[model samples]
Target: MFSGEEQGKVQIYTGCGKGKSTAAFGLAMRAAGCGGRVFIIQFQKARRCGEHESAERLGINLAQCPQGRGSGPCTSPCPLLTAARDILKEGGADLLILDEIMAAMRHGCLSLTEALSLLETRPAKTELVMTGRGAPQELVERADLVTEMKKIKHYYDEGLPARRGIEF
Candidate 1:
């Protein structure tokens, strides 16, 4: 049972395989179940997904960047980055999930320094989780827990598009 008083830790789920967001969402659910406030900020995404619906039902706060997918690296004054900064400053969430943040970093939408700064300034009791591929070694080294989802094989390679609810 979660005490609901333990200090939060930084967790990263990254790799080329799938389940990174799924794993983070699972943690979000678990945290919420334990009576913890949860907030999720999805970077470089705009389309509504199954998680958005589930998040509402579960009382988790979720916000997505309007820039959407395949826009390339975001320029200065990225809305997602600004939103993240504001969320961190407000300081009410017990668990904060920066969904696809690593992908944003990879695409240059967000910088390593900014991400690390966010980590440094977040509320001490707020648990942080980042999801996406190609997580930089710097983040991995600083994280308290890291899980790499290696892709040995995927159905996407078989000409199957992402399915609703399952992949979205």
Candidate 2:
């Protein structure tokens, strides 16, 4: 549980490189180690992965919102946005990670206004993290900490597929 006195900050990890979600998960583990309640909501992702298993094992709350066919920007209500609003209202999490939310916005599953609202309305004690590529300038300007991972070199360039337990 958070001490209630600790101030939380908004952090973002975005770029064309890998390790954005991995870094967020690492922070989640650290926060959990210190006895903070952590929640992670993954947007545009439904496939079960290593992080899902790890989060379950570590007792972190995790949910995935997969975009079905015909779902596009404002085409239908976004499940992830709904879930995020509910969680924010409940204010149970000490750390909330919106994994791949930037990608969600890029893919037209979420909007800039909606994302900004999430930032503006989050609980005072909840640390928020958003990840994925192509973070908009608006988000970057508002985030307390923003790290853009530069992809200098990648194994994928050599024609290697993403490996399980490494890429997932």
Candidate number of the best TM-score: 2
Candidate 2 Cα errors over 4 Å, as ranges: 68-75
> How do the residues 89-160 of candidate 2 rate in per-residue lDDT, one tens digit apiece?
898889999998887887788789999999888988889999988899999998899998889999999999
Instruction: Show model 1 residue runs off by greater than 4 Å.
Output: 1-4
Output the worst ten-in-a-row residue range by lDDT, candidate 1. Answer: 1-10
lDDT of 1: 0.86
Q: Total backbone clashes of model 2? A: 1
* lDDT tens per residue, model 1, 1-168: 145567888999998988999998998898888787888999878999888899889999988877787677776867788877887788787889999998788778888999998888787778889999988899999899999999999999999998996988
Q: How far does residue 117 in candidate 1 sit from its true spot (Å)?
A: 0.5
Error of 1 at 35 (Å): 1.8
